[model samples]
Structures are given as C-alpha cells and as structure tokens.
Target: MDIIRIDDPRDPRVAAYLDIRERDLVGRHGRFVAEGKVVLDVLFSAGRFAVESVLVLENRLAGLESTLRKAAPALPVYVASGEIIDRIAGFHMHRGILAIGNRGAGQPAESLLATLPAGALVVVLVGIANHDNMGSIFRNAAAFGADAVLMDATCCDPLYRKAIRVSVGAALKVPFASFGDAGHITALLDRLGFGQFALSPRGETDIRDAQRTDRLALYLGTEGEGLPEALLSRLRTVRIAMAQGFDSLNVAAASAIALHHFSRGG
Candidate 1:
C-alpha cells in the first residue's frame, strides 16, 4: 500500500480534504467528502466513483489498511495525526476515515422521464430541506421499488454527508435529478402522460382506491408546510387512510407507506 504521511494542515496536496469543512469548497469542486469507515466502504464498493484520495487517522491506519488494500489498492491513502485532521477539517472527525470523490452529473428531466416504462411510479420532492429526511425518502423509494426521485430547486442535496449516511448509501445508486422550476416538471410529466398525484393531508381521495393509471408521479413536500397550494391544485390529490387519532405522518414515514402501497398495486 502506498501511504503518504501528511503533517502540515495547509499542505496543498491535502487542500481537497480540507475543503470538506466549507460548503463553498464542495460547490466549487463539485464533490463532497464522505467520512467514517462504513460510509467510505459503502461508496467504494459501489465502484461507480473515482476516489480522489483517502485520509486515515494515524492510530486507525492499522485497522483500516487491510480493508483498503482489498477494496482500493491502487488509490492513494494519507495518514495524518488526529490533531492535524481536526485542525484541517474544523471539527473532530471521530470516523477516522474520509474520502473525496466526484459528484455524479444529474440527467435532464426529459431524459429521466423517457427512461421510465408506462405505468411506472415516480417520487417528486419539493422544498424538502432536511438531509436526513431526504436520505430516508431515497432509501424507502429504492426499497419500495419506486423507479426514480425528482427534486425541485428548493430541495436539499441528497449527496450531502448527513443524507448519504442516513440513506445507508442508497443515494449513490438511486436515479435522481433536480428541476429549476415546477413548470418544467409539470410540462415534462404532462408530455410523458404521467398522472400526477399530490400526497396531502387534505386530499379528497384515499390513495388505496385512487385510479391506478399508467405512469404515476407522487409529489411530496416539506414536513412543516406540506404541499404548496398552487402545485396541489394542479394535480390529483390523494391521501393515505389513517387512524382517526392521527392527522398526518412525518414526510419520510408517509413516503415509505405511500411507496409500499403503490408498489403493492394499490
């Protein structure tokens, strides 16, 4: 294994790793750092990303070396003292393993829409800012057999650290894209003949009995505000039949239930 010892926090070679602390840095480089052995291992096993580098705390090197040798022998791994890593990253990185990789390019809405078969079920998230919830939604989508995830401009990045971790790496494999405007999404879905169903608490029809048409796009919103009134009016409103005591479920949980129902031919 080729191991480089990095002591200086300002070393140019380690600049990419340091950038993990700054949001602007991630934006400029078009990549984010994934920390912890499990998260890094999950990303590496996917074999879809080119790892720029790996940073391991000196004390943890022995334990992680064998794993890296088998999983990414050709990649460069850097050993840094814990204090140095903390100084560089602006936080205590207890995970001990950090990796830098390129972000995948998102496909156009039209192309994504074209790839799905007729009668397929899709998920669309609008203004969902919580990375944890975003990740959970992605995980559920994959588990329940949803074909794709679409995000509006206001949605959080699913590739963010908290999201990626919360998703248990499902975000890396799921097909997703973001739209600049709701109209762009509506137009594309309209062209593709997808019956848009807005999942709202006040929906007039229960999702179980709602007409199962060819190609359905389920629209979910932020937890606090629910679906936007304007977008709700543009689509067929459908609700999950809930027990009388509860008026709603958390967005992520609701997503899981709705996705499962749709997958079961509800």
Candidate 2:
C-alpha cells in the first residue's frame, strides 16, 4: 500500500475525510467516518458498505497500513502529519486512523416487512430524540432477535455517528425504516396484521400478561416525556412488572428487559 502524503488541510481530496466531525450538518451522505481501531475493524468486516478512503497520522498509526492492506488492499489510504489533521478536523489527535465508507442503502418499510418470516417481532420508536438511547435500542433489538425496527419521523437518525458508536455498530446490522406519521404506521401495521402494543410505565397490563401472538410490534417512546399521549391512546398499552420501590428504568435499559421478555416467548 502506497501512503499518499497530505501536507495541506485545504486539499479538496481530503474534504470528505475532514467533514466527519460535522456529520450532523453533512446530513445523510456523511454517515461514513468511523473512529477507533475497533470501530474501524467492525466497519470493514461489515461488508455492507464500500470503502471510500482512509486517513491516518503516520507516527501514530505505524502498522495500520499492513492491516488495511490485508482488509482492503485496493482502497486509497492517506497519511497526514498530525498537525495538518488536527487543523482540518478542529480537534486534538487520538484514534489516529479514520476510515470513510459509503452509507449502506436501507430497505423501505414495506420491503422489509414483506421479507419477514411468520411470527415476526418488530420494535418501533416514536419521537425518541436522544441518539445514545436510539443506538442502545438497536443493540438490544438485535440481541433479542427483533425482525425489524421502525422509527417515527420525530426520532433521531439511527445512523448518526453518536448513535452508531453507542450502538457499537449494531445500527449497521439492524434492518430499520422511518415513518412520516403515527397514523400511517398504525394503518400499515394493521394492513400487515401485526398486533400492536405500546410500552409505557403506566398501563393496564404487564407486558408479560399480554398473550404471545404470531406477529407483535412493540412501540417505545422518548426518554423523559414517555410515549406521546395521542399515539398511546390509539394502541394497546403494556407495562413491565417491577419492584414496588421502583417506578421506572432508563428507556434503553427498559427496552433491553422488554425485548428479552418478548424474545423468550413472554
């Protein structure tokens, strides 16, 4: 692998490489910058996305060239002086090696649903604004073998950098789609014949009490605010049994427990 040296931060070729820090502003196309050795390894092994380029600080990323050569020999790897990289990225240096890849294409909601096996379990999020919670939800959903994930328009992007890192790259593996409105989601699931259950701390029945159905869709809401009142009014509400001393769990933790319960035939 030939190391292409980059001395100027102003180089147009490295613009995408530097744009990673401002991923939120860059919108969908900027979903590619992966940091840390472990994350980079996961990104490369995923094979769902194409490698765009790689940037590294020579002194810090000594043997990474051989690693990249073994994993993606054909991709361009750029080596920059630490100072130049820092200037361009607007931050101090750590995790010397950064790799950029194209965002993998996601299947539409209807397409994903059509491919599901009978008795599928799906998790849906409505108006969840926190990226970390979104990522953790994806991680839990994957761990529990959820058939698919659906997000309402008000929710944060699951592929956002913070969400992706928080999910530990689980977002890359999970099948997910976004719906523009709750009414559309309800109607679509009804059309697909899915039994919809909304998870809320305050509910008439425990999640365990609900009969295990052939097709179940779990609806979760935002952190502090909980599920939107209007949406909750439209779906069956279910709660998790907890000790009398405790009233609630963090949305992510609650999701893990709930998903585990459903996965185990609850």
Tell me, by lDDT, which candidate is best: 1
* Weakest ten-residue segment in model 2 by summed lDDT: 63-72
- Candidate 2 structure quality by residue, lDDT tens digits, 172-215: 66778877777878888878888888889896788878876678
RMSD of candidates 1 onward, in order: 3.1, 3.1
**Candidate 1 clashing pairs?**
119-215
- Expressed as tens digits, the lDDT of each residue in 56-82 for candidate 1 is 899998888656864566787888998
- The clash tally of candidate 1 reads 1
